[model samples]
Target: MTEQNEEKPRNFHEMELDDRILKAIAKLGWQNPTLIQERAIPLLLEGKDVLVRARTGSGKTAAFAIPVIQKILNIKQTARHQEIKALILAPSKELCHQICGVIKDLTIKCSQEVRCVDVAPQVDLSVQKPLLVERPDIVVGTPTRVLKHVKAGYLDLKKSLELLVIDEADLVFSFGYENEVKELMGSLPNIYQAILASATLSEDVKSLKSLVLHNPVTLKLEEPEIAPESQLTHYHLMAEEMDKATIIYALLKLHLIRGKTIIFVNTVDKCYKIKLYLEQFGIPTCVLNSELPAKIRCHSVTQFNQGIYDIIVASDEKALEEPGNYGEKDNTEAKKSKRKKDKESGVSRGIDFQHVANVINFDFPLDAQSYIHRAGRTARGNNHGSVLSFVSIKEKPLLEKVENRLKTGDNDSIFKANHFKLEEVEAFKYRAKDAWRAVTKIAVREARLKEIKQEIFNCQKLKSYFEDNPTDLQVLRHDKALHTVRVQQHLSDVPEYIVPPTLKGMGGLTKRNKRKHDFRSAQSSASRFQARKSNPLLSMDFEGFSKKKKKKN
Candidate 1:
């Protein structure tokens, strides 16, 4: 591949793109090009293959998307419906929809001339056939979905396609889509320009580079994997398995963590465990793990982004051990019957969780990349965000390993000890223990079952049918509570009498109206990383976490 670097173009106008494209950029309020856009756009417009490594939320979508739209617009002016001019492949269904959405936004003015369709939905081929029949200029989907379309005679990337972009190239391999990618590449027209955009140049990404790129210009930016220490503050709090719930409950109840936030857990079980555990304390959360269906997962993110929910409990990455079973959350007969990981279920990496203020690692990430993807969810687009990880005693080694990978200078660990000591929330001890006890293993499993069942019926095609037949929807509705968690209503409200002095001014953001008022007032106060610090944990003695405690087993 060609190893030449081009001079940076300061803005979108400098790239000599179509005027309509520039107008759309202006409409979107993009005053200047991001580093990725500045470097990658010009090369892409030049019709050269590019392998880019930039941080997430760095406008990577627009970097390749702008050129793709511009070229299609230009072609539409002269050519008679240039069918399938571009194909964008992502790792998950959520990301496919996201990329397609970006393209549609950019083509707002040119929508009539240049159309894009997301072929990643888990709907029937017959359902999507009409859209594919129109032969959209831009088709976005995961590798398998795109290949499925090609095999089913719905998409024709072998001839008319002029550009191919593999967004989140690293994840395509990790998701075990290398074979689909290779097969898709072989069937594609060899002369089409390609762009491989990813956060890292992992072995998989490099392999993708060799397979698709023709003397591609690799753009590895000097930026860090995550936002800098200033924009994104990283903190790790030590907590054992049992007390993790107690700490999270106290933090959210007292409003220590605020703004739109995502709590990342390791296993699918942990996603529900923290979510259901918090619910016992009257904290509501949306679960966005791999167990949920694609349409529901995507809708959950959209709703979360639109401020419908303040918190989302999600699993960040794939399975660490087996390749195929990666991100596979359940081993129940229903889940085991289907070998495919939730095609729509993904959070980190490609799917954008907009304006996220905080990322709490409820379970310390299994790997460094998982942590990076989780961290990338927040502090995006020049916005300030924070990461607070709960590290247990044994997980300290994993923490060190993650910090080691993040080291730029000697001994410069990116994650530091969280200054917020768990001790200050001692007032909530009895309540927290009471709440934690109510969250049983049965509740977690029940929560998973209900989520899976509801989402199964809520899938796009079925939902459409149910929309016309509303009574059927009502008939299939789950009326019963998923779990028997003895939710104590008093746990939802923090009485003013017990309010800690340090956290006094906020008025414990428990009440909805008061919380909104306090939230706005707090936002106006220039306290972005506000209220993180608290005193040390008063007692690990409450549970089996104490060293003096005997082994129950």
Candidate 2:
């Protein structure tokens, strides 16, 4: 493994790339290559197999995408006929779709010469056969999906395949696609140039490197996994398990944590638990988890990037530290139903969350790597961000692990004490309970069921989900927690008395400022809805809520 961190200044024009590729990069508004792209692109273009260990949001996708497309174009120049030459496999379906989109964007100028298709194994195999039948120059899908197609005779890649890319390589085995990956590798032509790109060098990643790369030139970037101290801030608050809800309630309802934020929780149920508790006070939030349909998950991310919602409660990180949601060859016994976690569907792993200003860990992550990846969502692209975690007495050990990971770097400790006193917002405790109380267990169950039905039965998009599991009985096990978030408009407003005392010193952010922020958030949501009527995904479930909101007014 080679280590290279020297970032010599270089631009897209400096690299030996095709004119059409350079033109597409300009259209995407990329002024220069990122450090990872600058270092790895030249090596990949030279046909050197690479094992890349870089953090997320480090432009790693384009690090491989640009070279992959350049090679496809290079092949097309001399080859007489087109064939499936490149295969890109990601752990989750969402990541697969994202890579496909990025590849397509880069191939805009040379689309006629290079073809790419992103497939989701979660979807019915029959539906994707046509996309595979075309024999695209590049095929992007999960290892499971790619293997299924190859076995079904829909995709013939035993001979002409030349390039293989496994993005998010650490997550491949974690998602329980190890068997599929091994089988797919056994079928592929062994002479192809390969790239195993991952954010971390976990045991699984090391195992994959031995299996995938061939005398590969390793590039372990010198950049710290965590952002610089100047660009981001970290804070920790000690709270009892029972009062955890109260702390987050005070933070958001009092306008303490400002800007677009992502609140992270551990279980799928917790995602809804927080969203519903906030919703009881007329807060608008979206729930993201693995159990949800792929379409809904993808659309939620698109709307979030577009600023349709400021707060998103997501169940990720260790939420995906379970088995992949595939293959029900075993009998439907209670023990066998543990395969509910969708390895490919995680918000924390990689989902392209743009301009996220804050990441609040409602529950601390299970491991150091989970914390690192969750933090990766924010402090992206020269933008400043903050992560505030609620640490309970029991969670102190988890907190220590995260702190120790950061201690190896420049400053000793990154996690700071809570800037604001919890006593200042003590008056809001009863109100927080009132809101939290309304999020009954029954409500969470209904919300979970309704969410599944809305995306599955209503949209009929869970072809892969249903195919793997014989019944929805297993959903009840993991989705036993969650809440319906719509409520009266009066609950949305923050009463003047609920303002914390010491917090007033920070820009005089009184109750009025909180209201002002809410008003602006609402205005943006309404404006975005009016601007794009054709995008119904963003507008889903708003009509009924608006009617009730108007009645409350």
The estimated TM-scores of all candidates read 0.86, 0.84
Off-target runs (Cα >4 Å) in candidate 2 are 1-8, 317-339, 408-411, 461-489, 501-516, 519-553
What digit string (tens of lDDT, one per residue) describes model 1 on residues 381-470? 767777889898877877887898887699787775644445566667777776666677788778888778777767745876977896
As for candidate 1, its clashing pairs are: 1-215, 319-327, 423-536, 423-537
lDDT of 2 by residue, 247-292 (tens): 7776666544556688898767777778778777656777788787
Poorest 10 consecutive residues of model 1 by lDDT? 532-541
* lDDT of every predicted structure (CA atoms): 0.74, 0.74
RMSD of 1: 6.7
Give the candidate number with the greatest TM-score. Answer: 1
